[model samples]
Target: MTSALILENLCKSFGSGADAVQVLDHVALDLPQGQSLALTGDSGSGKSTLLHICAGLEPFDRGKVVLAGHDITQNDDAAGAALRRDTIGLVFQQFNLIPSLTVAANLAFQARLAGRHDPDFTTELARRLGIAQLMSRYPEQLSGGQQQRVAIGRCLAARPRLVLADEPTGNLDEATGDAVLDLMMELAAQAGTALLLVTHSTRLAQRCDSRVHLRAGKLQVPA
Candidate 1:
């Protein structure tokens, strides 16, 4: 089967000359459709940098990023933005929901941007995330877990082929975090969306189909 996401010899750097700092050094990875992979590492180990590169949010100095059969690594900014809007979904630890938008509006935001808004799907996701009753509420009115659910729901509403999560459960209590992770995995599986999750929790990483460790800018197969 064709991979849902692939990265080949990925390399990224920041600064220049004497100040140059390499974040990714010839990193490579692939995730088949419907597969889930967890990325774990210490602070500044390139986990988030790799995630950003995969999501087309950051440019790589050298490498290829193919998502859902499109090689978007070299696409122009506009093309990359379009590709990301159409094929990629990202969830961050901060639950970056718009404060002025209601839960339902936030859930529909990405879908609207992608021009693939499906009322039925958004409604179902809201219900599944247990935010249906709070659809009219603003982000500020909800708890941290509730806001994160809305964030997840917003991503799912886009029906993205690949989902990138960065420390998605990092802000929640243990019970809430587990519950959210479970819901995310279940939903991603049901949608056949490949998931690349960067997390620090060993238990969470173990729940994925594969676990990888990143250290000193290199990735290793979990022992």
Candidate 2:
């Protein structure tokens, strides 16, 4: 079976000449279906950069990144956006929920955009996230943790081939964070989606199928 995600000699840099700051160097890794991989690194270690590059929101100067079956490193912006819309789910530190839309609408947004909307899946995901009762409610009406659960439901409801989360539980307290992470892991597994999660907490990272560290712009299993 094809890997859900593959990074081969991925390299990225900013600026130019002497001022050029290389953020990613020959980074490589893989994520298979129905499993989670934790990405842990110090700030400025390029964890988010790698995520953005993988998501096709940013371009790399070297190497390749394949998402699902597409080679994202070769795609232009339009193709990248399409891939993101059709195959990828991103959970950010900020909930990023639509303030004007009801929780149900927000949950259905991406799935609809991908032409993969399933009312039953949306309902089930909302229920699993513990936000089914809040479906008709607007984002502002919910607490921080509630909004985050809605955000997670939004991603998983789409049934994306790969789920990329960058500090998804960062804004919540420890207990809430743990609960949110647990829900995300369980939902992703149920959907058979590959997950690449960027986090700082070792306790959280240890729960994943594997853990990788980013340093000097490379990814490696912890020594």
User: How displaced is residue 130 in candidate 1, in Å?
Assistant: 2.7
* Residues 1-223, model 2: lDDT tens digits: 5699999988899899999988898888878988899999999998998898889887789899989879986787798899999999999777899999999999999999999999998898777667889989999999988888888889988889899999888877988788778888887888788999999999999999999999887777996
Model 2 lDDT, residue 136, Cα: 94
Predicted candidate 1 versus true structure: per-residue lDDT over 1-223, tens digit per residue: 7699998999888999999988888888889999999999998888888988888877889888899988985588899889989989999777889999999999999999999899998998888777899999999999887888889889889988899999887767888788778877887889898999999999999999999898777889988
Which residue runs of candidate 1 sit more than 4 Å off their true CA positions?
none
lDDT of 2: 0.89
| Backbone clash count, each prediction separately | 0, 0
Runs off by more than 4 Å, candidate 2: none
